[model samples]
Target: MNIPLNRHSPTPIYLQIRNYLSRLIQSGKMLSGQKLPSIRVLSTSIQVNKLTVIEAYSLLEADGLIHARQGSGYFVNPKTTVTSGLTLRSNFSPSQEVIISQGGGSFFEQYTTSIQARRQQNIIEFSSGFPSTSISDNLQRVAKRALAKAGDTLFREDFPQGQLLLRQLIAQMLIQQGLEVSSEEIIITSGSQQALSLAMQYYLRKDDWVIVETPTYHGALGILKNLQAKVIGIPMTAEGINLELLEQYLKSHRPKLIYTISTLHNPTGITTSLAHRQALITLARQYECFILEDNAYEGLKFQPVPPPIKALDRYDLVTYISTFSKTLMPGLRIGYMVVTGEHHQPLVKQKLLNDLHVSTVSQVIVSEFLASGHYRRHLNRLRISNLQSRNVMLQALESYFPDAIAWTIPKGGLFLWTHLPNHLPIQTICSEALSHNVLIASGAAFFLGQGYPAMRLNFCHTPEDIEHGIKIIGRLIKNYLTPSFISVGLSSQEVSVSSMR
Candidate 1:
């Protein structure tokens, strides 16, 4: 194969190679089953590294554009048959549903009841990013104490920012994390979700450009879209967001804000390294753009937590947002934001008008929880359980799934992101899994408009549940990929039997 390489293109050389080969296959120049050169041969021919060739081949294989034979060579997919020398019909269809069940909007409001209707149902749910129930008891005990001390004053209109006690606790925590924020800098909100919403309301305007990670938290994407913000998505890699591309986008478009989940990121579960964090902060400062840091999962790390981007932010360009939703309890609806720079007071006033302050009772309850040192101990226990669950899930995936399904080995977070064969639609798989009394989130929910085929699995369940659920999901995926299964319709018994294996 004669392939020209571009040295000037900002895109990675491996991706360029992948794209070139993909075009060839799509154009029918490379027929199905045609053997390609080995990775070493390709690397030598292209004057690139062998690892680059390997990466290109892996990407092609993941996309089902090509297949690999052990100890042989890569080839166009042999099973991708053409009829009468015409192109094979597309097996995938775009999703037409206006809204997804587990996605943005109030779909949860209506579906939450129906989903919980089957209290006896033993299905392991990976839909919501729920923290374990073990942490809830600690919050509950603290709440009871708060209630007893309130004596009716807690319900009255209190400090607009939040209870001073809660703010002080948040400040202390930030100081421990190496951030120079004080109690006055912290503004409490109903939840991190609310904090994000408030940030969007305060900063973004109609048609303002906002930068986000390609597959980001669905809730944040939804809010940005609803705000009519012109959103640009930067692809995420194992290291972090592509900082080079981010710099390019910043130089060109000059977006209003860059919203990111830097620590224990959602869905993908990749943490941004300190080097990348500094680079991003520098880029944001250079571009005169603001950084909205969503550190919602900061405490869920099984490993030592990486310092947040805010810690490295010296110019006050970063607006740090986090919550106790994952660490303590979601129902408390307690979260806070540290907004620096000149715009802080105006943002606070908007927040006051938006909700007239978060519930004082909840803030006091959380404050007491943090003050008693119970929250840290509870987090330690939760981390241990979460780590065990994550390990078990990793083992199950490795044992049962094919190598074609790639995933990130997250350091710490509730979810693991799995990239399925691009040809297989994750939404279809999710629908099929639902029929088997198993539920997994479709990867499409994370994208802004059109999304790639992927899924996020939460490893916050019991080991048995994790094992059983992975087995079912893995088998379902295998059946979906089977040539015979695709040609003929799948049966309930066949699916169940495969799941049992």
Candidate 2:
């Protein structure tokens, strides 16, 4: 093996040696299953201390790129993909997050694994993006009425554009929110997810440039990856997406779409200010780009919220979407989007090609629920319940979480984004929390490339579990931060107590 040692550099000699060997393996210079030089030989060959060579080999072994037998020298791990010039994993992981060089790495794989693990442990998802269970009774009542109304047409499918009555109701609701649009412009979808997919399918082509708010909605990011679009994420401040930065991107990239959940944004809990909304609309018009406004968390605000960006879209530049999933019930699978202009016909046709139409029975139920004003009453009750639940979560976070941890206090939404200390190992924290049967949504899943130490905590679904989970998680973080943390993890008795709590 030919290797040069740089003694004057700031990087540790062990790390440098590890990196050189890593490059050789990655570039296929070192074949898989090939033995590395013996520690004595390499140490003498490089004129380095044996300890430095040992440390380098140990690091490589930990990376799964190499292995050692009791008697044999280190050999490259045959299972590695480095021989083919592929990385074993993305830079982002549950344990340590590094800045992404490119977007569209598979975040769902890690995220879903965490969820499935929690389910195996029978963990009630406090980190669920779903709404509070308190509305189940009201939902059942409306569902029955809807089923009765759909007795004959239950088998008959609605048009490709969706059930007209539901669209009319959605149009009415949007009008009240100051977005003037006729029912003809609206298309009912299976859910906000489908609506988003339809829009991306209609307007975006492979390799298309798309702009989105940093740490926006995870679902939208997932969709963007499926569509094979190049995603540009604009970091958001307390005010909202940085307009100055957005303008720079708009000027440079002129992306075809700007996808955002401007109202009580998912993960972050920020509602873009009305002035910012108006500015964004103007920018979209100037750049001839379309704005896809995902208002999934439109209502449930603790206070009067700003109007959606769609409301200010005078040039028909904004495609507005919202759903009953967050406000009412998710099982309904009913959502709608108002789209007109050039993209209208294709979206309807594409939606038809996808699903003939959203569930007819579900749409009928939602229509009656909305037209009878029951939805309004339900929304009021929902706001109160969610507000109380959010407060419970906030208090728990404030009381139990470490001082190094900071979190958002969204005015009204199911999520509170918690930012962990940068230097801490998020992967270890996530693993420890799982031992306690608590789950958290990794913040990395929501970003295009914004790798940071954070996770989104859901407050509505597990209101009762907030205090308990927070207590357990707080203790775990404390232990990990202290000098005594030795990965001893939680005791079985301790885990059982947590599960009981």
Candidate 3:
């Protein structure tokens, strides 16, 4: 392995290595079925992170130039078509254009600004993804009890993997849900967002191909863009992710990872069937790719749903991430992931470098809360309240919204995915709604490619607010559709909020 890296080049070191190897394989210098240097040996010879070498080899594998045998090193694929290999443009990458060109602001930036702007305006917001519940008296009591029990341990540096007690409780909860994970395998983070960041940083490098659901969680899209990974969006169908398109991408692209929200998916509120779960697991196994399953809203569902893709994973390929923010207070920010095998040590190291660990007080309190069984009781109450709120919103949409506008009836979760007529742009609608003191999430924020005319409305507000908000949005759409309004070429800014009120 005589590959050299350009310290001045804009392209990543991993891609540089991958390109060099690809050229060799295609040019016949590396023969078919011949073993290449092992990851450890090659990384030592080149003086780079082992993960970087792994990434380069993984890309070569994805390009069909090589294959790996367990307990053995990677080898040139015997049946590879040697056509100059996958080309890397000299001065361009898709990620450089993805964030700035698609939509300027990220989901976090947009919603944070929205929250601040509306803090004094008393705006009823449908843009939030979590239930806005205050800390209960019982939670306060639990926190005090946890503090009392902390003794001197709270003052000392704790494990990077997080509080063991919290992990044990989480493992028990997961066991009830059908996953065979233990406390040692779990790593606690500030939130599921941090967990996602760790996994992405560990597995994905620049120009690596990854698959995601179109209209997926905007947070994940933001992370992928930041990491400079190429994303392919597979549309969500009635059951789950479009398996047909997923498999096709698997065969042709050989993506490194599949990111999915299997149960109580955000924005759309679609849960896949058991068979759909099985098929997804099978596809990932056949393709020899990993799956990052975000089950953030799993606890919010009203009906019974299938176990997570992790529970069905026989090959230890799925990385399961979830958070207590959706069920508990969002400020708690306690999330965990179950990692096994080679990925564990690296992810833990990344976690240590990222923030050391989640807040000690937050982890301790949550641990005590779970141990006391208050968490289950809180979930039951939350489900009932959210269900009532959802029903009210549905009724309001039926009464105030036009027949042309449609929305999904979610079994559980905070959002209702609404589809607007293709002729209308969601960005204009969101801006006009904001002027009227109603904030909604424009669907444009959720896509990596071309976005559709849709919006995600949260059902976590009061019945009165939900009805009033829906009515205002419906009126805005109706006004936009009116013949006189359209003929006059009235802009969204020209629409009078006073008249609507």
Candidate 4:
């Protein structure tokens, strides 16, 4: 038997032998009941060690493709009966719904809920939307320091708009960034999700057109879907969303709302240039559409990005939203939006209707943290630690991942967006990853239409786990590639990490 091998390749020799033999068996090159060569003879023929040949034979034996008699060599198993493709398709059931009956939710709704509610587990979290919990102990100190000078203002609500001090603090910070705004313009909420939902409720009616980037934030997409907006998804280029397409849609459809993440955009992490920002603002003006800018990762930038689209919103077309979820603590659940147009009153009214207002305590605690000058220090530390984490993941991707795979190494932010080779079955690969105790955010969930062969990996995980998870994913992909048909090796059973080792 001729077995071609690349001894210098990173793939283990035993795995290569097993795969090659598996391929031959499936292809019927080796006849059923044919006696195989002895280990010593096969090793000499392949110019490999005897142990390597033995391990390969052992694997094939375990796979049930070959059998070794008591004193004789191995023999290939008989070919399994083949079912016609048409017969299988005739049996295929389309439109079947997997009803998970815990609360009886729709598939997409249940999917999004499960994603958001993934309990903290001992396993590495590659799908988390929040930062690490290493700061939990430190936050007690922040909370204690924030409460030092709490007067009656801390006990009682400041006003209908929210704690006036927090609003003033948020407004002052925006002013420092060159936005002309006041405390009265800011509306605090439970989190940016609430801020976004309020904006959606106030402006968007059922079937009103709205524009969003392809591969946009899933949360925003879910909100827009729930609001029943006629959503238009523009493909995002390196600079930002495709402007040509934006203009085309604006001229044709005239969407009422243009929701965007102008800086360090969510999954892709591509920041819009100042020119792109200016052009987008102009497009909104030309089309008379409102801009809803989510700036959740604003302060997390390692390299400076262009000023936010909201900063350039002299036209009052932009409703700027930000939150402490990315920068400080998600548990605080405090976020605010700056509204400055004719819709300001209605938006604030919607905010009041949403939850009356965010918790008085959260607003006060966040307010005190900002007022104490500790927030700036916290921002600095966050940038440093996250950047290091980003580098570690980048190195892992470089060392462990294959060359055909493409990924983004963001200047900041917790995610690394990756594109695998097009032909790979990404869903099956993701399913296999789950079996290995590794979780990933499939690129399909982020798209409005067909998803690319991609995944969004969180680089902010424990460094050791990051390395281990990525290496495991790479190996799984290679294993799939080896079997070619995604049906050969893993046809009847899963090849797990334990099995691989």
What is the TM-score of each predicted model, taking all chains together?
Answer: 0.73, 0.73, 0.75, 0.72
User: What is the C-alpha lDDT profile of model 4 across 1-501, one tens digit per residue?
Assistant: 668898899988988999999888878888988888888889998899998987787656544567665467777866533222211111101111111111111326534543554564655667666677667555678787666667565666445568888999998767645566889888888889888988887878987888887667878877876776767777665567778778877887787888898877787766778999999999999889999999888777765577778888878899999899888888899888999868778887777766777787788689877776556556655666676677777777767766556666565677767766556788898778877888877777677655456787877766788889999888887775643543332122121111110
Candidate 3 per-residue lDDT over residues 1-501, each given as its tens digit: 768899689988998999899888888888888999999989999898999997787656534466666577778866412123321111100111111122123777766865675465478878888786566787788889998998888888888899889999999888757788989999999889999989988888887888887678998888888888878777665466778768877897798998899988887888888899999999999999999999999888765678899999877799999999998888889999999877888899999999987888889889987887667656755766777787788778778876666577777888878766656757787889989899888888887655557789999888899989999999988877755434323122121111110
Worst 10 residues of 3 by lDDT: 88-97
RMSD of each: 18.6, 28.0, 21.2, 22.6
Instruction: Provide the lDDT at 482 for model 1.
Output: 59
- Against the true structure, candidate 2 has what lDDT? 0.74
Report the candidate with higher TM-score, 1 versus 4: 1
TM-score order, best first, reads 3, 1, 2, 4
Regions more than 4 Å wrong, model 1: 1-121, 134-139, 482-501
After aligning candidate 2 to the native by TM-score, how far in Å is the CA of 122 from where it should be?
4.9
For residues 1-501, write the lDDT of model 2, one tens digit per residue.
668878999988998999999889878889988999999999999889998998787656534467665577778865311123322221111221112222455456755664474556467465567775454565687778878877889888679998778888888777657688898999988888899988988779998888887777777777888888877777666667777768877887778988888888887887778888889999999999999999888766766677788877777788999888888877789888888777678889999999888888788888888876567656755665666677777777767876556666687878778766555677787777877788766676776664556778887745568778888877877776643322222111111001110
Judging by lDDT against the true structure, name the best candidate: 3
The reply for model 2, stretches above 4 Å from the true place, is 1-122, 134-138, 461-463, 482-501
Error of 1 at 39 (Å): 61
Model 3 alpha-carbon miss at residue 279, Å: 0.6
Poorly placed runs, candidate 4 (over 4 Å): 1-121, 151-155, 482-501
